[model samples]
Target: MTVASLEYNGKPVVAEELTPEAFKKFGYVISPKDQAPKIPEGTYGMAYRLSDASIPVNNYGNSEFKTEAPCAFNLQRFKPPKALDRENKVYNLPNVERHPYTTQTFFPMGVDAEKAAYLVVVCENDENKLPDLSTLRVFVARGNQSVTYGAAVWHGGTCSLIDQLDMTMFMYDNGVKADEVHLVETSGLRIEYHL
Candidate 1:
């Protein structure tokens, strides 16, 4: 329906550093920084293992969507939020969405890790499969980091802070009703970030 119809606990969220352990239950923080090298120091020595946790899941089974292209690898661009309060480094969240049948991933392209960042707001589902505001969490992700939203996880609109972010995105879709969006009526839901 409309954002005015949703319920939100009126409190702003201060974003914290994203880490694998902290984000494990929701999804993951994908990055190459601060990890021991996993490959032998020879041919593929440059490879530092990040994660293999992004395997797609079809909770509703794969037979629901009938289409030629079930998955898409796309190059996309995201600008700073229209609702961003740059001087205050805050972004007002209007809504959240979820892909109930597949995971979503974004890889930042040519982003300067030191200069720009983005906000990722997530919450767990309630017994009725609605956004549980009490469990909401916000994370500040650097340009060096990427993220994969686990299947059926609820997340606020992706907002790039400071500068535009170009990315490669991957997701499964047949252009149907499996993608869900909940309009948030919570007036104070926001992300407070550090510039």
Candidate 2:
């Protein structure tokens, strides 16, 4: 589809409330509901566990998924953009990135307990292995929520709604080019959101 023919003045996409059902296509939503104590006693902590059996993980062969030597553990701090006035408006999106061989998880931290939210954008790959702009989706995430993106899922950078945010990022890398891939929109496309 031509970029001009798309909605949102050719660049705007209305972000929706993040939900487990709506985000299943991209990856798993690690929310309180999903992590409810599975045991009858409900005494053990952290009822959910992540493994290759349940989701895609890159360093299965390694005894421990270590990031200090090869992979990277990043503590990213996202600051709210100055242009953001309304919660429903997503002003601009320059590019998107994805980890093809690894699953990435974003764990929120150091956010205000009362009011903390962020934006998540994802897109599927087309036949050409490029981001299918038509499949793009936007989600608003709260502070208590963490998202684990499946391998090869196109996603944008962290965007905070409050003044500041801290998110712990986990990913695997072997000093190779295949670790991450970034894609830019050539048609000057920008997505805006409407209420």
Candidate 3:
């Protein structure tokens, strides 16, 4: 058995609308729509949402991420699996990971709002500090959105749908051990969806 379980109960997990209210536990939804009605003016009127994101790292528990870790920016390319691109409807959740010391953000680039999409699969930690399967939740994030995985939260991989997607990700890192913790589960994670 893996560190978690899923509800493949025949009907898929319907990647419904994502809301910051419901998603606060895992992280936050960072889209223009989620921004306050009035964009706060800064030193320059052009600056946008500069102070909106959660602090890059949590400085609690004597965490080194604050003083020793450098905020790393990376570009990621993701595509649907060969077996389940635009033709198929089901996706398997093969793995999950957590960045214990820092919050991670993903911003899709040049994606068409109508055609590109991805799933956000996340869950809370169990009493034993592992991913709690019963709490798993999946949200559909489209081209206009960005997601931030809170520090120490467990979440799935890219899981994009339809066409290929490119993303810019930001996170704090030490380049070893504190980078990420992963769980690779081979079965029992069939996610059904329709493009």
Candidate 4:
């Protein structure tokens, strides 16, 4: 796992030069609507809601993103403390509970789209430091203020600092929603963090 820290002092975060051609094998695609389109396959799409009441604008390019309800807040970096059991060794499913379908909006690419991807942007408001993920490659912005991942890049869930962070993300590859979410018991199946 690699860890990088991004500090902010009222400066803009510049996008890194990530060309689609460089990640062709990983299914990269450029969205026509994006001025700097470099969508990666099977990745998450991160964007601030344009229609938010707190920050609304008519223009797509220059408009400010609004942070409002139906939003996900206060998330931590996702890192599996241990690995799962092998396929054959598994039997019944793990404790699978259905959480409420959140009203929060997330960027979703065509799961069936030949080239799918997902993305997450690290934009914190209070100058909080970013977390580290094991074996994950994060293409950070020039100033280390933020970063966007490519398609199908293996990752964990929400861990954003601020409510509104301007970002262009993509989701790629096939998806699944099975009845059971399984996890096999292992020695180091837990991760401890100090807040």
Candidate 5:
């Protein structure tokens, strides 16, 4: 079997289309069919539960789980990389991060219907508890769907393929420091995605 490398100078890994089965290791894919709302005859609506208490309390301890505060919800806007303006080729991947104690979700919104696709990069941890660079995978997500990252899974920041993109993010925290660990130094790797 051939191994994969993350670094890119010009030629980069082409991103694959996002799918539920392909993204299982990273987290849950929130689709209309899987997230249909339970309602009465006269009601019209849909719901998608992002995360739950099913996440294990590992390093944060039991006290961290006892907080009565609700999860934080915020809108995040992403801008396309400058490189795209010059050569419509690839987006550089400088860093990746993970939330050790809680699941994180993002719902895309306010996207131009004609160009609403975005990119997501992820990798699984190796035996040494560091990101397995060879396992890095890229995905293109549509605006109609939401994604929930599993606790402690490595993932890059949100990116857009078009000029501007907005997304609603949900996660447990004080909404201050963004409880996450950057894996760039530990993994010592970088990557790029083909446009």
Candidate 6:
């Protein structure tokens, strides 16, 4: 949906009408409500030790943070996947690990509209088949929604333009930990966002 607003000096000034189709053009998609994305039953990914031991001194008081070693953490950035390319082009956002509740803010690069449009969700310990998309609730993030995605929840990404988009993602997890080996079933659901 289109939310209208005026932008002059790089600040939100108004709200406008928005539709799922219009938003999808720039890679904004509605989170599927009908069937939850199928998360096959399995164990959490492997855990790796934080190489930087001294980092704890500075990070002690911090609730969450992006690891300094971007490469080490499988950190990734991408243009939101498009139509036929959906399944084959999936890109995993780095570092999903178990954690306690905490708040993290992320500002995506160059999304200019009255408000931002995207889908986000949180789920845990579910092995049911994914439901239909038409039956689901697609959450559109207008401004910063301090929503907490539970540990091991499957979620989607922010919408971005054709150009490179950088997101300062934050996580409120227990400590600096990275999970390895995300489990993907041999066969999976087909998700398509109307563009």
- Give candidate 6 regions above 4 Å deviation: 1-76, 82-105, 114-124, 127-148, 156-162, 173-186
**What ranges in model 4 sit over 4 Å off?**
1-17, 29-135, 141-153, 158-162, 165-176, 179-195
The TM-scores of all predictions, comma-separated, are 0.83, 0.72, 0.78, 0.22, 0.69, 0.35
| TM-score of candidate 1 versus the correct structure, residues matched by position | 0.83
- In the range 1-195, model 4's lDDT, one tens digit per residue, is 123332223222222232334322322324333223455677676633323211211111221332222222332332211221222211111111111111112233222222212222221112222321221221211112222232222223332222223332322111222211111121211221111
lDDT of 6 by residue, 33-149 (tens): 211245556837743332321111122233334444221121335465452233342222221222232222344434443343343422233344221222222233433322333
lDDT of 5 by residue, 1-195 (tens): 112334434335567767677888788776553445655676556433545412322333433444443577788888875533325546567666777766788888865433436777888887965667677888877777678888778887787776777888887653223343434532233334443
Identify the superior model by TM-score, candidate 1 or candidate 2.
1
Q: Residues 49-159, candidate 2, lDDT per residue (tens digit)? A: 545322546752442433432556798987876545546555466566776667888888965433447878898887867777778898888777788888778887676
The runs of at least 3 residues in candidate 2 whose Cα sits more than 4 Å from the true structure, single-residue gaps closed, are 1-11, 33-56, 59-72, 81-88, 112-116, 186-195
What lDDT would candidate 5 get against the real structure? 0.63
| Worst window of 10 by summed lDDT in candidate 2 | 1-10
Clashing pairs in 1: none
- The alpha-carbon deviation from the true structure for residue 109 of candidate 1, after best TM-score superposition, in angstroms, is 0.6
The candidate maximizing TM-score is: 1
Locate the minimum summed-lDDT window of 10 residues in model 3: 1-10
lDDT of model number 1: 0.72
List the pairs of residues colliding in candidate 3. none
Lowest lDDT 10-mer window, candidate 6? 1-10
lDDT of 2 at 105: 85
What tens digits encode model 1's per-residue C-alpha lDDT throughout 135-190?
88888777878788888788876788847788888877656653433344555676
Local distance difference test, each candidate: 0.72, 0.66, 0.69, 0.24, 0.63, 0.31
Q: What's model 5's TM-score?
A: 0.69
